[model samples]
Target: MNTIKTIYLILCIFAISFLSRFWMSEWKWYAQFLRLKLKSKEEPDVGFDNKRDADPNKILQEADDIYQLISSTKPLFDIPPFERSTSAHNSKYYIMNPTEVHSTGNLLYTYVETYDYQGNRKTTGGDFFRARIYDKKTLTAAVGSITDFNNGSYLVTFPLYWEGTVYISIKLQYSSEMVSLIHRLRDIDNYRMGFRGIFLSKNYKEMTKCHFNLTFTGPLCDLYYHNSGIKWMCEKPKNLSCENLSSLEYYFNEPSLSEAEKKFDDRKNVLKEIRPVGASSVIVKKQGSNINLPKCQSHPLTYTNSTGFVQNHTWISSLCQVKRFRTSERVIQCIKGKKIYLVGDSTIRQWFEYLVKIIPTLSKVNVGRNQWYSEKLAVDLTNNIYLQWRTHGLPWHPGVPLMLPDSPSAVSLINNIYGGKEFITVICLGAHFTRYPLKVYLETLIHVRNAVKRLLGRSPDTTVILKNGNTRTPYKLLLDNDWLTYELNQAFVAAFMGMNVSLVDAWDLTAAYESAELHPSEEVIKNEVDVLFSYICPNID
Candidate 1:
């Protein structure tokens, strides 16, 4: 009788353990159904929808228990956008340390005074002022650093590099008032852009709208993609259940800001060049040897006072020796028998397009073409070369419909990669995420950072590069301003600071080249890729 009792007890324990495993396996579907109940009227209570996006444990961690690793700006001005929109036309600058002739090794400063479009002398400062010192004859250029006093004054500092007829160009992109408003708008208009939801069943198929906020008056489906902590909801099909929901699509809608609000963003009046009362150009003589650094090798890319500058349209990096791989033979010889993955916005896609355009041996695979946000692949089979470029996950507004099932964050892609010495991954993310909340972008960085850590731990030889955001035309206003990109770049720098990744200072590269374009000229992109090749074929002669 005792032996019989023991056997029964063991059997009961075994059955319970088996059932527990099954319960966890159904956690997602069961949890969704349990929380969702069709009721008498108001939108179904999907309060747990947010919780569903991230793991319960992850939510606690995402509460941010780790050490604070990112540094960013919080715009100081709180006045309305139109109330004190800065006017570059009314701003003026004069030399701080005036001298007959400037010496190469010294630093010089210029002070600026700002005024509002209303002609009121501004008392607080948030002017996005940019300055550059360049000499055209020698083809020498460098980006200057600006210091804002928050008291309606700015100090522009220039380091004399190559001497001889250097012109100072100062551009006041946006005043503090407009920048503060732009910052506020980002937090307020999270759903200014909308998305499409597609669902299907055996005998029923339906298409409806999906978004962070829904207006439909009926049943809704809580959508979750693989392991991503993003909240999305769609209208349930009239005939089919929530389980039939399939994919999501994203695109731009009309601007959410009112005409009154639009007054703050006067694109036509943006980024006026300001000149000094006295001389705007200076004469300088040579001091140092341009700080010629060692060739770009497998080492991490670091930044100096002059991270890099444009000389005769060539990017000279103080951090590494940047080599120009201008021809196909040079590129193919260096990258043959390798796999290159480029991921990010259209800006990064330029790299993919550049490679295929220049390398005659490289023919694009049938992955599709000319779409801004499509996944692309090109191959040079003879040399065993593989290249692919895909846009980063959501918050992405591809002009055309993007299949949601295929959309993935850099973190998702990195997590799935098992790399070798020949495997190279270049990631550039920021322009797309600027419109969302800071928390969302931070969450993305944390996930990507962790994913990168895992990837390196698994494959120590794999190369990972993080390209920072750069200057863009200020005329694009609220969403496409450089100030927003600057904040994102700051967070990016801090998150990837200590990793084994190469942080290309694209900010310096584009600005030094004086490219106000988000998609800079081909020569600029070519120089950018040369920086990439500096890594792939490090220290190449």
Candidate 2:
């Protein structure tokens, strides 16, 4: 009888465990369903029904039209007739000398001259130009420095990295827009131009007296600041300095325009190819294979050890001791049983696009009119892995439809997710918010923080990653610029400090490249995604 009792007890224990597991799984699904139902009721339908054009050619044509509009309207100041020069007017524009480059670790020199349609060199210095050196074989680029002499002449310097055929590319900058950027840089209180931090002091006098540091050290003040200025008076208990502050002089800098220009230019500004007048190619000879390239390690942020930045190029992270999944099979294994939710603007959408391209079986779900803000699900049933991309609520760009029902807030979306060790959340914001006040962005971030906190309170093992906004070439029609995004990125970092989250540091990754673009090249995106994968599956090889 005792032996029979023992067998019954064991069976009862197993039954209870199985029932509990089943209940939890059902609860998660039910919770998500309830939230979706509530959100649908809260958001009113806009009564507009439209579907995105599915024809690839039509999409491409529409993209070209947009690019043309952006490029044609980019110039804040009209090009003076005297500054106009045709390709046929060879003497009107020229590279003064043969491009000279060192084998390695040396600055290459390139001089450019601009002339009127009459072929006379213009003496005024307000014209802007950019330069870059591209490896012929790989097409990889290194952005060159252009120092305007203000005498219709400019000097270009390129950093040598490898031995190969190098092609030079250059572009012109609008003078009026450059001046506006300069003025914005000089204003300390401009939210888009200046740095921001969090100060917790209850003492009103000290808070009012804080001042900004003016030196190089001041820029580094993101993590460290002097106590003497009004900027230094924040309380010590939870004070956190901004990360990745930009110097006032950084506003004037312009990097090369590469594939990003061609990719982002929705309308072809000029029917003809826009090529630099005096194009030249030079061969870079390899110095030594052992030449030491810089390596970046993670640096801890103030207030939390949960996140950090790599002092080296973010690309290096993929090649270093960091583990990477080189095959689809490996990637499947790494992400098995995990669900990833990517939230933000089109930039984050790029990441989703890349994953779809790489994973063959990951198919898109067609939701008709709900496609814009609808969740795109890519499922690998064999691995039980699911990936989703959703647009954040509000401040939608004009490019997106205006009549669609509002999507759930990022915070709300995050809170509703069944977060745990198996869940990953990635978020990026700023490009759309550039036109709004800084306070608006801050309020949005605060809401996100609270949501993140709630998520952690429920599932401390959930991994959250934030991507910083990238820099972009200056365009007057588009109010977004690298400097403005820099401030926004800083605020993003400050808002999440001390939280249990990691940062992808897209700002530094984009800045390190020769091309500083809002949407960086595929190589850069690949690296960014790799860095994210490193966090998601840190032990994967």
Candidate 3:
């Protein structure tokens, strides 16, 4: 009987252990479900109708905690480590077809003048300000933040605050209609249509006695900084300073100044606007320390009179031709000692960077940053072939600093001088200027085409490849129910005379098979890179 009891006890213990394990798992699952339910409430709902257009960034941000945990275990799978190195190099391609759902109006412009602790002009270091803007309307396509303005300065004020000696400046580019709103606001008219919300960067949060001029005056005018939101009651002042005010209370009180005085005060602090200086200083991994200027290996191509300021040239002795869509080795051999180039706005930088990333490390690369001009990256080949990446003559987009043609910014001269080198040059110039009226397009392209003509002289052999707009997703559809890709391409292509330069259809190469329906997929990138290699180094099989 004792032996039987022992056996029965062992069986009972085993059964209890099994039951406890099962119950523990169920409890854990229940806890997970509850957490997910709570999270769903806080996270923004990504469009599920089509997964292709969903934003991976938003999804990743939501699951940040999990990423942190996994990151600690295996650094590779974690987002933080992967992001740090890549983010610096990450850039958008020119072919990105973004839809402008919001009205194209320059609605808001807030200019702030900086003063030091001694009440002198603080022009050397940086200044800080609070700023906020909202997307009043829902945008189907990906919305981009107005990161840096080309008004000439790179220091930007943010809406959020961070610890440290971060100095900030505010710059923006909207539409001319938006700029008009500021004028009306200063006149004491309706202000609702102008700036939607406020934005402030970390740089402003740490400042002490800061004085600035509020350029826009409106019926519902108020000054907000940190937790202090002050409504001004006095008549519009021409100039205002936070320096005299003993506390935040003074900014709330209406200034006892006249309109003319206010205008003068506002003008005193305003300096020249800032512009997007492009990538600051880029360090090519194994190639060199820093680039001095945009330079490349010059390929010899014939100068033909094209519609633009570039020349068209091809290999005199051919290697091979396209056969059943398959490239022959002979065709590859013909492209020896030739270099191609792409120059345009930030979006074009994306396409250019992607090409740079894939090229074999054995190839030579150079990266440079200039204070007055755009960032540059140049690659040299074993042969005399050299390729250059530079952006010049970007037309002003409203709310953003006007890309003044006179402001040491024009590609016409550079292209002409560079043309002396006998080589193929493929140029990409689009976006970065829709805010300017149609006249801006005509004027800008005329200079561009003229530069091409001056460089190519008069020849058919020089190939001036013009790229079309990239494909976009339906989510990017705007109020007009049309994509800017079609419009932008039409405008640019129409401005060009195709006789001398050839147009390489990039829309198909970059965005043909993207599930996002906007940015190119990895596969698409590979294909585009392949095409670029074929054009630049046709001799390499």
Candidate 4:
């Protein structure tokens, strides 16, 4: 009896220890989130209405314009799948200029003519195409710029940056009908994810359905953020008041695509992954060494920004000089005395993760047991380097459920910072926005832009970096497709056209290196951070 009792006690202690750790781990990020919010609440949350005065029609119109700018490919909501699917095997492509030897300084273009399974040339443009010119021997690749002429034909342009035999490849990610179906689904419902709001008080505890959009037919407590005017809703509690809302839990909401939409996201289907109809490769020779490129340092990216190509697995930016801080000592020195703030999707979170890893002196606070969860903080006391990152609001489908307050817009993060020369803010958005509709994205953009305006208004010397969207593969769910990412990025570029903040061209950075993963490889992340710091410490080189 004594031995059995001791064993039971031991098991109880072990279980208690395990659960205590788990509970603490789960709650730390939320604790930090609240602390951060409280510290920054001094900035009046005038709410979202003032900044959201953007003409809805104009914003939607601009969204349409971005699609046309990328390719004359609009979603075919009314078209049938049979008429819209492009046949990869039936399609054909050829080099416009198949000369014996291509010059490094010259321009090369290819015309890809997409066809249906029936070998009929497509009349409307909506095919998802990705092009790259790469040399296997040197491991050099440059993403090809594609122009959909609204007809079946697309113009793929490549700059001959190096002297080598480079092969050209094109892939049809989705058919026009499929793309159209995806768009139609976007307008049908705004709910991508769902949440359960847990309201707690002295004697009552309850959980109610909550979501960014209240598509459910029920009485809901429509609540708005007192400061930013951001709105959120939850099913009305049976007896408890909505004011008792204390915590939130999230669940992944399946896209639930219809039969036609299912074909586009399925890899087993022939409608996707069509990579044929193009010349294998061409050779080129360097003309001269007359190009004296400037460093990567720049204020804001421009239309005519010079994008130097990658050579020998390194990004050589012609936009401005780039100083690669490869060593820990170099990174420390460059970022010393700098308080860097990162917010947005997991991409920005990558920087926070990388920084703490590379710099031994930088210690990450135990914000949460789940490393993947957002709301992170790291401090380098000796260097006076403070680093923090948070995930953006709605449409954020983190593997772990986050409290409502933990999931906030980048605007909230931006507003909280006390900007100065010592502070550097890097915002990487649009990854989550890529899959959202135009109107939703435009409203979010207005909020972010206005927050940036406020940040700059107070501290003009603060260095602001807007990390644009990176290229990602269109997998079973094309939610974060390469084309959609680009479309949203262009919108960001247009939204913050003249803003003081520099919109870092992540598209070119990722594409030039052929980094296509939604969460790209760490090497790509490194290059991106290097590019970001190039502005933070332009003289590091």
* lDDT score, candidate 4, position 414: 86
lDDT tens digits by residue: candidate 2, 91-204: 222233334444755445555555544666657554434345665456455555545454565556566554567676665533323423332332322333222223332441
Q: Mind giving the per-residue lDDT tens digits that candidate 3 earns over 1-541?
A: 5654554455355544433543464455435434533453455322122232123443333334222321111112111211111110111111011111212211112222333223333232111111222221211111111211212112221221111121122222211111222222322322211112222243332112211222444422232221111122222222333322222211112323344323322322222222211211111122223223221112322211111100011111111221111232332243345555556554455655554454442243534333223445545354344555556443322233222222223344334444423466666555543322233334445445555655565433455555555554333111111123433454455444332444444443332221233445545444344444444443343
TM-score of 1: 0.80
* TM-score per candidate, chains pooled: 0.80, 0.48, 0.35, 0.81
**Count of clashes, each model:** 1, 17, 67, 12
Residue-pair clash count for candidate 1: 1
lDDT of 1: 0.70
**TM-score for model 2?**
0.48
Q: lDDT score of model 4?
A: 0.67
Off by over 4 Å in 4: 1-72, 202-204, 215-230, 252-261, 269-278, 303-308, 368-370, 473-478, 512-516
| Error of model 4, residue 388, in angstroms | 1.1
Candidate with best TM-score: 4
Q: Over the stretch 1-541, how does candidate 4's per-residue lDDT look in tens digits?
A: 5654554455445544544543464355334433432432355443233333344544445444443443334555555666447877777766655545788877676667788877788888777666777787887777666666667877677878888788887777667776676666554545665678788888779888886566668778764541122356889888888888876676545677667556666654432444543346888989978576555443543342236566666776656666687778999988999998887888888888888889999998877544665479999999889998877666565656555566666777788888999999887767766555665675667667767767877887888888888877665355656666766776676555545566567788787776758787778777777788888887664
Ranked by TM-score, top first:
4, 1, 2, 3
Candidate 3 Cα misplacement greater than 4 A, ranges:
1-335, 361-366, 370-373, 396-410, 413-416, 420-422, 458-461, 473-482, 508-519, 529-541
The digit string of per-residue lDDT tens for model 1 on 1-541 reads: 5654554455445544433443453453334322221211145322223233244455434424221322223444445556466788777776654454678767666667788777788888667777888888888899887665557876677777666788888988776766777777665666666677667676566887776557788988765542235555777777777676665667555456666567766776666797566668877778656665676655433323357678897887767778889999999988999999887888889999999999988988876543776678999989899999977776676666566555666667777788889999988888877777655676667656667767777788888888888888754578778888877886675445435678778898888887888788998889889889887888566
- What overall lDDT goes with each candidate model? 0.70, 0.51, 0.32, 0.67
